[model samples]
Target: MELVDLTTTPAEALPLTAFKAHLRLGSGFADDSLQDDLLAGYLRATLAAIEARTGKVLFERVLQWRLSRWAEAGHQPLPVAPVTAITSVALRNAEGGVSEVAVALYGLERDTHRPRLFAKGATLPAITHDGEAVVSMTAGFGPSWDDIPADLQQAVLLLAAHYYEHRSETNGAVRAMPFGVVSLLESYRNIRVLGARS
Candidate 1:
């Protein structure tokens, strides 16, 4: 996979827990009442976006499917969308050192520049090249919809879907950037993406 540092982030990345999980999963805070599942449900409806982007299964099964209007219609069960995901994979011994693959993806309601975040689970690492500035960069694939295995794809997609739901609801009060998905693909040799809409 060809990795590119779209834009570098700070080395001091936040913890995965700090990012939102699919709200439909209950916010990990309470059982139900307190939180709303709408945010997560909305993201779940757009699972196809996964294949369209990386051509992989970024989610698991319908268990995590969002409770939405479309969902009420009843089709064949679908996977969830991503809220946050990784975009880098690590190579243990390569080129006299370690190598990483970076990824980036985004979705839009229309023609606006909005990257719909996806990956619900991901660990963003602090990257810095031997340049002048010590910028934390990430790299991976492109606006994919590529191909990955089944089980692994499910895991990635599920996480993305979950995160999308949670993040959407929490960030509703304030307009936040599309969530980000960063992952180590190709058995940790390639970096892949599936983040909240960018």
Candidate 2:
């Protein structure tokens, strides 16, 4: 199965000013405007890194996930957390024709950490063509950065600050995260299983 992001959060929705304040930059500094842009870049990078690390979308975004088949015959776990809704599901034929799956056939098994697509009946629809079943949905904690939990918000700021502080470093011994950041994100990280779910 492959998960593709259909749309990402806009730049304006990121906590740019918050990050600047966290960095202790004065609001009226000469480089303040430039700093805002720089902070945006860092925040974007850090937000992606955090989402990649945690499997939790901090802000709402549309995602398209492709799958060869359903898991456990009746349900398939979503790759990200806090799924707000499943927009649609489609099956593509061998001739490249796509057909939509009815909304009444399936629904979301909602959870902040591991949402899943649960078939309403005994079985899920069969895809005639391989690698063509696609599930489109929106997933995240909230619609904006302010909707994110305080700990995650802090984690983003700290990690962005770390990235900013070491922007010029070329050392090969860089750690993935500082102790504090790691501690802050530990509870949010997704623990992937080595094999298929039982």
Candidate 3:
């Protein structure tokens, strides 16, 4: 299974000013704008880390997912949560041909934790041979920083500040989430249920 982000949150939509305040950086400095870019980078990295840890997308963005086969005949659990819409579904047959599944045939089951794709009738189309199936959808709580839940927004801010302050001691390239971050994100994490898909 492969899932890729087709679109990402706009840089402008980030809470640059708020992050600056969190960092206690004064706006009077000539390089303040430049610092905004740096802060934005930290926020972006922190958001990515939080999302990776929690399996939740904090901001709304388009994502494309590819799977070899359906988890179930009628209902396919989406890899991500808070899916807003299913843009399209495509099937690649064994013969190396691709076709778009009719939108009316299936619909998105938008759940906060375990969103899924459910067939409208009988069952979803089956792959007869070696092939791939693709599902594209929009997922996330909201489109902007303000759209995110208050706790998550606070988490991002706290984590970004931590990253900004610890840049000298830690490797910025490594996405090592701190315990405080994990604690903040713990409540938002999705708990996978193990059982037969019935």
Candidate 4:
């Protein structure tokens, strides 16, 4: 199985100003914007880490997931959430032939944690032998930073600030997420059942 991010979060969508405020960095200075780029990088890294730990997308973007076989015939659980829509599904043969699946054949089951692509009938279209299925989807809370849940927004700022403070640390020790950030992200995490991601 492979998952690819099809779009990047726009710079304007990031909470740069808010993060600066959180860090209490000086303003109205000649070199005020000098650290902007570095700060942005930290924010992006923090968002990615939080999203990976929680199995959630912090910003709205398109994603493509490819799999050799369906987890289940009637419905296949998506790898990430909260999935807003399923854009398309296609099957690609080993010989490079592609066939688009009809939208009428399946529908998106929107859920905060475990969204699924469910067949409208008995099962989803079958892929040829030695083929793979590609599912394109849009996932995230929303496009703007304000659209994120308040707790998550706070978590991002807190984690980014931590990263900014420790930017020069070369200790090489593994750093765990702050307790507060972990608590904030707890509810958003996907619960695995019986050793399987739900």
Which has the greatest lDDT?
4
**Tens-place lDDT digits, model 1, residues 70-170:** 11111111221221233223433322355443433211111111222222224223223421111122112222323234433444445455555455376
lDDT of 2 by residue, 1-198 (tens): 888888978888988888888988888767678766778888889988889888999999999998887777798888888899999999987788889999999999987678899889987788784547899998998888879999999999999999998888889424478888889989987676888352
Q: What residue runs in model 4 are displaced by over 4 Å at the alpha carbon?
A: 194-198
Residue 177 lDDT (model 1): 22
> Clashes in model 3: which pairs?
none
Q: How many clashes would you count in candidate 4?
A: 0
- Order of candidate numbers by TM-score, starting with the best: 4, 2, 3, 1
Q: Give per-residue CA lDDT, model 4, range 61-124, as digits (tens).
A: 9999999998888899999999999999999999999999999999999888899999999999
- lDDT, candidates in the order shown: 0.30, 0.86, 0.85, 0.92
* Number of colliding residue pairs in model 3: 0
lDDT of 3 by residue, 1-198 (tens): 999999988998899998888778888877779776788899899888888878898899999998888888999998878899999999998888999999999998877778889999889888656899989999998898888998888889888987887878755643566677678788888876788343
> Could you give the C-alpha RMSD of every candidate to the true structure, in order shown?
20.1, 2.0, 2.2, 1.6
lDDT of 3 at 33: 93
Candidates arranged by lDDT, highest first: 4, 2, 3, 1
C-alpha positional error of residue 196 in candidate 1 after TM-score superposition, expressed in Å: 31
User: Model 3 off-target regions past 4 Å?
Assistant: 170-176, 194-198
